[model samples]
Target chain A: MPAPIEFYFDFSSPYGYLAAQEVEGVGRRQGREVVWKPFLLGAVFKTTGSAPLLDIPMKGDYAKRDMDRSARRIGVPFQLPTPFPFSAVAPARAFYWLADQNTMAAKDLAMALFHAAFGQGHDISAPDAVAKTAAMHGHDPAAVRAAHDDPAVKQRLKDEVQAAQDKGVFGSPFLLVDGEPFWGHDRLGDAEAWAKTGGW
Target chain B: MPAPIEFYFDFSSPYGYLAAQEVEGVGRRQGREVVWKPFLLGAVFKTTGSAPLLDIPMKGDYAKRDMDRSARRIGVPFQLPTPFPFSAVAPARAFYWLADQNTMAAKDLAMALFHAAFGQGHDISAPDAVAKTAAMHGHDPAAVRAAHDDPAVKQRLKDEVQAAQDKGVFGSPFLLVDGEPFWGHDRLGDAEAWAKTGGW
Candidate 1:
């Protein structure tokens, strides 16, 4: 057994969705409790001087292809949602609210939202969609929504994103095991291995 | 048919080797030529402030895994070279010199070197090994050796690396099709598509 693994994410990122789906089983197998830390990706990127694919067309187009290839390789179904680069504020706040209830539940709903946004091509910003996805994971959608609007919860999400920046994390789906940051979904294996061997 | 593609490369990168192995076939199918440009990775990194792995340890380790997984998914034979990062200066310079004799020859030898370095785990810097590999591609071993040591040829390679940086290439295995730069081996398909549409 090892210390818990915390995953930082934004509901808008497809890679974060993949991590949410894939890293759960990996964490359980390696005796680590996978904690979801949903945060604002836009804030982190702004401060870190990073931009989405829309800013760099060459890298962005390639990323979409790589994500398609990666999902297929990993055996996950994928469908890119329209209205890409969707606003993540509402969904991100909902995630923080749910995480305060049960960390694992927050993770499951996050994946469902990802599947909706990037996999099913649904808009997660729509309150109905976010509520429906949360309900699927056994949470009272209205209660989750209420908590989402709480000033403290909203600030908590903002603080987590800020904390991520302090920890040298500049991207979504960052996994920190015993405080060592792993910045991509692809690195989940390393996160697991480190948990298993207690390696850095 | 589309115009020829300008393929930029750094021999130290495993992906460049992978692309070199397959780009010609892609070019031939589309009735386009590949203009191979061998450049120094060190120079590109120096100008762009791009460090390997973006300062995330877990992400860096997982990247190696993802690369291996990508290689396997592509059905390319690969063996991790010992002394993980080998000296690439000699082979990169040789590639530049060989371009003077035959661009196609340079491309072929570069693939062979990649297969040798990453596929077979051979030391690409060794004179005997380089000569042996060059001979397999029908290049005169003695001439290859002589070209490697030519002072003028070495200077030309530095110039090419600088030129690549000036062109906003901050990464290895950059592909320019229809004047659009596709960075990274992961973007090969996009480059191929552009070649098909006479884009680059």
Candidate 2:
């Protein structure tokens, strides 16, 4: 079997949310498992010395419009969460904690959290909101909330962020197919092509 | 006739070169004229407080790889010119000077210059080189070289750059169809769709 497609994202990223909605279809079509790895974009931004897209001059306004247009084009419901670019600590921690038990369940929880954050404009940055979203996916709300403060879960997220940096993933919705990195939600097609053809 | 598609680009941007090769076709397919506007990205970068893609930390490395992969995928020969991200003042000035007389011929010169700078790895940043490339397309070498220093032509480029910034153009290969902005070469399809459907 081919290597799994490593899908790296941050919970606060709109593009990441959009890609999460579509990446699995690409994975299923190509006979590859999509490993959903959620990390902290705030942490990644700090290490890269980059600011959030909505904070940059000129480009920020354009990004807002582009994100809306992109989501619309893909037939996905999207709205920028209030107090956006919030610390994704709660959601990231919940993902790793759930991932330790059931990978698929963790992916489902990630999607639920993403939908709550971007689709419904809920602030998943809050532990309560993240736990509520996880609860909707059949996970224990109290346990998921507790996972946010678990020492091992927090370190797991930190290590994953470090691993992403070590692998040179500096952007959300970053995909790795056999260690070939493709960044941006726009490059999903190229990533799938690379996965299918094993590079041109 | 519908409003023409405005193709904004910088000479030194690799994606701009790739987009230049493809944007005209998009315009043709959509039955719209593509007005190629060569502006100084350096000026745009100043206002946007952005750095060259090849000068950024991790993004720089990924950009190099993505550029090659994107070029290969599109079947275009591409090589990063020596001293890339060089001053495109000469080329931008020459384009405006020629554009005043013949827009089509100016576009031809722009494409030739793009080919020289990216396809052949020649430094079209130099006035002499720009003149030589223009001369091959039936322009007078001396006239083309003189236009680079022409005060009116220089001012024209400056005005164009300012206009682009005013329109919120903060990146290379930005396409505007009926005033809707689409940045990046990957968005050529989006731009074309918008032009065809008058937006969704």
Candidate 3:
């Protein structure tokens, strides 16, 4: 077994959803435990001076093609639920809401929300859509909505986003094991190998 | 048959050399011409607020791995050049010197410089080394060196670097076939295809 692996995810990114689907299985194969850390990507972009993929003319197409190649190579289901970038504010807040109730429930909610937003083309930013998604995963819809609006819950999500920035995280599906940050889904194999060797 | 493709290159980049060796072959098969454009990468970085691969921790390693993979896939002979990130001043100036004489000489000089830097691990920044490499490729060493230091040649090289910035180039090995800029060696194939189809 290896040190704990922390996965930081943003519901708005298709790559984050893809990473969520296979991270657990890969970690299990390498005898590593995993935890989910859902954070706001907007905060990350503001702090890092990062540009959206669509803004970088050639990079977006290349990245999509590369991701498809990677998904096929890894034998995973890959789909872009929406053609446009979905606002992730509500979805991100819902994650923190789940965390306050139970850790395991929070993990499940994060995966469910990712599937809804990036796997099924839903507008995850809508409070109603987010509440509905949480309900599908067995949480009370009203309770989840109320929890999402809590000032403390929203601030906790903000804090996690700030933490990701401080840790030098610049992109989605950032995985950290034993304090070493691995950015991008392509680094997943390296992350697994590092985890296996128990390298910090 | 297709229109000539502009091959933007910088001697300091290993990938540019790798692409140079094969781009002509690709052009030959499609009955197209390759226009060699040697510009300073440092100038591009300054205009775009970008850094070299070595400056981006995880990305640098990814570049090395990708280059190795690309070499095997393309059957190109590749070795990590010594004294990497060489000063591009001399080489860029040397290339402009050759270009002033004739286009063919510019093409040959570009290949020779790439091979000298990445293939033979030579210090391309040194005047003597560049002269020797040019001589080995049948160009007159003394003439090439003299042309390199000419005030007009120096100014021309500086102007081309500035022009590349004006054209929105921010990275090395940028291919602008038919007025469209393809920013990486990986996009060489696309540039070639675009040339073949007369697509900008």
Candidate 4:
């Protein structure tokens, strides 16, 4: 069997949330596994000189509508958070912490967090909210809270961001199917096709 | 009948070249007329704090491949110009000049210019190159050259850019179907659906 596809995202990104709903299904249909990897988009942005989608002037309003339209088209529930572009550090750290122990559980936690932020329109930048989501997902809230602050977990998130940049991932919802980089939810279709056909 | 979809683009953009090849067909399939309007993207960039896509650090390389991949997917011919991001002033000026006299001939001229730049990979940044492409399309090269020197034509392009920015166009291949803005060549699908359903 071929290697699993790498799905990279930042928890703060709505497009990433949208992609989270689809990448796994696309990979499964192709008989390949999708490894979810969350990274710091801010770190990539520092090098790329790009700001958050909502921070850009005129494009912000259009992006807002596009995200909504795209979610509706894709049949996923979505609602923008009151304070968007929130910090993904809590979720990123938690994901890596859990991933080291149970990768599947970590993925469930990531999905729950995304649903909380985009589906429920909750503020997830705080560790407490992340812990709450973990509890809802059948994980211990206290353990998650502690893990969110663990130095090793914190360092794991940092190292992953550096590794992602080294791997040429400059945007959220980035994916590497057989090592070909596909950025954004828009390119998810391209990545799926590449995985199916093994590139053009 | 609904109003024609306004398609805005800049001459130097590869994505715009891709859109130019597909947008008219998409509009026609939906029984909607497409009005091609060439604008100076640099003007929009100034206000939105965006530089050229190729000027961004890591995204430049990715964008180059993305353009090629997108063109291939759309079955449109594409070749990066020899010193890309060349001055599109000549073509933009000529387009406005001819648009005043004959809209259909102006569109043909735009398509020919796009073909010269991306399809044939020619350096179409100069008045002479623009004239050459115009002459190839059965337009008078001498007359186009004179049109290039016309102040009214130059101002017409500038005014159009200003008007496009006012309509929240931050990038090339921007489209408005029934006054809803959709940006990028990636959005042609959404625009088609919007036109067909009169928007969801």
Best by DockQ: 2
Under the 3 Å rule for N, CA and C atoms, how many clashes does model 1 have? Answer: 4
Please write out the lDDT profile of model 3 over residues A46-109, one tens digit for every residue: 6445567654544555456545544554566566655456677788788777777787788888
Deviation in angstroms for B79 in model 1? 2.0
Which regions of candidate 3 fall more than 4 Å away from where they truly are?
A: A1-129, A132-200, B196-200
- Tell me how far the alpha carbon of residue A173 in candidate 2 is from the true structure, in angstroms, after superposition: 0.8
lDDT of 4 by residue, A142-199 (tens): 9999998888888898999999999999998999999989998988888999999988
Worst lDDT 10-window in candidate 3 chain A: A54-63
Model number with the top TM-score: 2
Residue pairs clashing in model 2 are none
Of the candidates numbered 3 and 4, which has the greater DockQ value? 4
Could you give candidate 2's per-residue lDDT for residues A54-122 as a string of tens digits?
888899999999999999999989998888878888888888998899998988888888888889898
* lDDT of each residue in A27-85, candidate 1, tens digit only: 77987777777777776665545557544533455577657756765678877787778
lDDT of each: 0.74, 0.90, 0.73, 0.90
lDDT of 4 by residue, B85-145 (tens): 8888899999999988999999999999999899999999899999998988888999999
Q: Report the CAPRI category for model 3.
A: incorrect
The list of candidate 4 runs beyond 4 A from truth reads none
How well docked is model 1, in DockQ terms? 0.09
- Clash count for each candidate, listed in order shown: 4, 0, 0, 0
**What 10-residue stretch in candidate 4 chain B is worst by lDDT?**
B39-48
DockQ of each: 0.09, 0.76, 0.09, 0.72
